[model samples]
Target: MFDYFIAPFSDYTFMSRALWGCLVLSLSATPIGVFLTLRKMSLSGDAMAHAILPGAAVGFLVSGLSIFAMTIGGIVAGCIVALLSGMVARHSRAEEDSSLAAFYLLSLAVGVLIISSKGSNVDLLHVLFGSTLALNNEALLLLSGIASITLLVLAIIYRALVLECVDPAFFKSVSRFGAVAHYLFLLLVVLNLVAGFHALGTLMSVGLMILPAAISRFWSNRLGVIISLSFVFAAISCYLGLLLSYHYEFATSPAIVLVLGLFYIASIILVKQCGSFLMKRASLAKLSIEQPIQNPSSIHKGQSNV
Candidate 1:
C-alpha cells in the first residue's frame, strides 16, 4: 500500500519534476477557479479548455512531439479565442456565453479535424488526457512558466478581480483598470488551462481548475480564507494524486483531477458543517457587549390630574 504511494517520493527525477509542476499549477488555478465560479464564469473555463484543442493539434502537426512549443501555441490560440469571443460579445448586444460556446465548439471540431488530417488517432490519447509518467523537462518548464505568469497577473489585478467577481458594475466605476483587468483574468485562465491540460487532460482540466476552490468555500466566507484553503487543497491533490497514480499504475493527470473532484464533493458535505471559528476570541467578544439605552418615560396621567 505504502510502496507505490511513497516509491516516487524516494527517487525519480521526472516524478519530482512532475510533482513541482503540478503543485505550482494547482496553486494558481485553484484560486482563479474560485473567482470564475463566483463570477459565474464557470462555463468560461470549459470554453477555454475546448478552445485549446486546435492550437495543440496544430502545434503537434508542426513540432512533432515538442510539448513545450506545442503547449505555448495552444495557450496562445486559446487566448485568441477568449479575446475574440469577448470582443464580439461586447461590441454587440450578443451574449458572451453564446459566442463563447460557439467558438469553443468550433475549436473542438476543428481540432479533431486537424488531428485527423495530420496522422493517426494515437496522439488523441495523449492530447485528451496526458501521460504524467512521460513528463519531461520541457513539460516542467512549460507548466512553471504558466504558473509564474498567472500569479503575477493575479497580483496586479487582485482587487479588480475581486470587485468584478462580486459586482461587475461597481467594479467598472471604481477601478480605472476594470476592462483591462477583466480581459487579463480571462487571459490567465487560458494560459493556466493550457498548462494544466497536460496534468488533467482536455476534458478534466476545467474541473481541476474549478473544483478545489469550490470545495474550499464550504469552510469559510472570507475571501482570504477561501483562497488559502483553495491553494492548500490544490497542492494536496496534486501531490497525493501523483503518488497514488505511480503506485496504482493509474493514469496520472486524471488521477490528480479525480482526487480534486473527490475533495470538492467531500468538502461540500463535510466542511459545510465543521464551523471552525476562533472560540477564545468569540468568547471574549461576547462578554464585552453593551446594553442598549432606553428613553425616559413621562408620567402623563399624573400631570393631567395636577
Candidate 2:
C-alpha cells in the first residue's frame, strides 16, 4: 500500500517533474482564476485558452515540437486575441464576450486546419491534449519562469486589480490604471494558459484555472481564503489525478481535470447541506429559548384574571 502511493513518483523522474510543474502552475494560475471568477470573466478565460491554439499550432508547424518556439507562438496568439476583443468591444456594437467568442472559435478552426494540414495526428493530439507525464527540462523551466513572473506581477497589481473588479467606475476615476490593469490581467491569463497548455493541453488548461476557482466559491467568501483554497484544491486534484493515471493508464490531463470536476460537485452538495443544517439548528434553538418565557408570562396573566 505504501509502495502504491510512493513508487510512481519515487521510481520515475518524469512523475516528479510533472508534479512540480502542476503545483507551480497552481500557485500562480489559481489566484488569477479566482480574480477571473470574481470579475465574471470565466467565459473570457475559456475563450483566451482557445485563442492560444493557432499560435501553438503555427509553432509546431515551423519547429516540430520545440517548447520555446511553441510558447512564443502561443503567447503571441493569445495576446493578439485579447487585444482584438477589447478593441472590438470599445469600437463596435458587439459586446466583449461576444467578440472574444467569435475570435476564439475562428482561431480554433484555423489551428485545427493548420495542424491537420501540416502536422501529424500525434502532433495534433499533443497540442490539443498536452504531454503531462512526458515533460522535459525545457517544459519544467518554462512553467517555473511563467509562475515566477505571474506571481511578481500579480503582487504589484493586486490592489488595483481588486479595485477594478469591485468598482470599475471608481477605479477608473481614482486611478488612471484601470484599462492598464484590465489588459495586464488578460495578459496574465494568457501567460498562465500558455504554461498550462504545456501540461494539460489547450482544451484542458482552462479546467485547471476555472474548476478550482469554481469549487472555492462554495467553501469561502473571502478573497484570500478563496485563493488559498483554490491552490490547495488544484494541487490535490493534480496529485490524485497523477496517481490515478499511473495506476489505471488513463490520459493524465483529462484525469486531473475530471478529479477537479468531482471535487466541485462534492463541494456544492456538502457545503450547501452543512449551511442548511446549521441554520435549521440555530432557528430551532431560538424558538425553544423563547417558548418557556412566553408560556410563563401567559400563565401569570391567566392566574391574575382568575
Candidate 3:
C-alpha cells in the first residue's frame, strides 16, 4: 500500500505537485459545482468550459503557453460568452441554453482553428486535454490564487445564491443584489474554468467542476453536507486518478475525469438500489397493515351473518 499509494508522491516531485494542484482545485470548484447543479446550470458550466478555448488559444499564439497570458485570455473569453448568453436570453426570443450552446460550439471551432493555424498538434492537445503532470510553480500559484478568490467570493454571495436556487422570484423581490450575485457567480464559473484549463484543459476542466457535485447528490440532501461530500469525492478521485496515471501511463486529465465518472456511476447504482429496497419494504408494511384490517372486517361480517 505504501509503495503503491504513498511512494509515488514521495519519490516524484511532479506527482506531489499534481496532487497539491488537484486538491486546491477541488477546494473551490466543487462547491461552485454544487451550486451549479442546484441551479440546473450544470451544462452551462460545460459550455463555459469550451467557451474559454478560443481565448486560451489566442493567448498561446501571442505568448507561447505563458500561464498568465493564456489564463487572462481564457477568462476574458469565457466572461464575454457567459455575459452574451445571459443578455440574449433576457433580451431576445432565444433561450439561455440554446444561445449558450450556439456560442460554445462557435467558440470551440474558432479556438481549434486558431491553435491549429499557428501551433502544432501537440500545442492543440495541451490546450484541449491539459498537461497535468508538467505543472510548475507558476501553475501551482495560479491554481491557489484562483481557489482563494473563488472561496472568498462564494462566501460573500452564499445567501443570495441559496435564495436564487431556492426561489428566484422571492430572491428578486427581496434583494436587489440578485442580478449582482448571478453575474458574480457566472464570473466565478469562468475564473474556475480558466484555472481548470491550466490543469485539465478546456475539454476536461468542467469535469472537475461538475462530476463530484453530481455524485454528491446521491449521498446527501443538505446543502452543506452535499458540498462537503463533493469536495471529498473530488479529492479522492484526483488522488486515485493521479496514482493510476503515474503507474499506468494514462493521460492524467482523462484518468482523473474517468475516476470521477466511475464514482458517479457507482452513486447512481447504489442510490437506485437503496431506493428500490426502501420502496419494497414500505409496500410490504402497507400490505401487512391492510391485510390485518381486512381480516378483522371479514370476521365481523361472518359473525353478523351467523
Q: Residue by residue across 106-208, what tens digits does model 2's lDDT show?
A: 9999999999999889889999999999899999999999999999999989999999999999988889998888888888999999999999999999999
As for TM-score, the candidate ahead, 1 or 3, is: 3
Q: Show pairs that collide, candidate 3.
A: none
191 in model 2: Cα distance from truth in Å?
0.2
The TM-score values for the models, in the order shown, are: 0.84, 0.95, 0.93
* Candidate models: Cα lDDT each: 0.81, 0.94, 0.95
Q: What is the descending TM-score order?
A: 2, 3, 1
- What global local distance difference test value does model 1 have? 0.81
Models, CA RMSD each: 6.8, 2.5, 3.0
Q: Which candidate leads the pack in lDDT?
A: 3
Task: Please list the residue runs of candidate 2 whose C-alpha ends up more than 4 Å from where it truly belongs after superposition.
Answer: 293-295, 298-306
TM-score winner: 2
Q: Is candidate 1 or candidate 2 better by TM-score?
A: 2
Candidate 1 segments exceeding 4 Å error: 1-4, 91-94, 272-306
The count of backbone overlaps in candidate 3 is 0
Q: Deviation in angstroms for 250 in model 3? A: 0.7
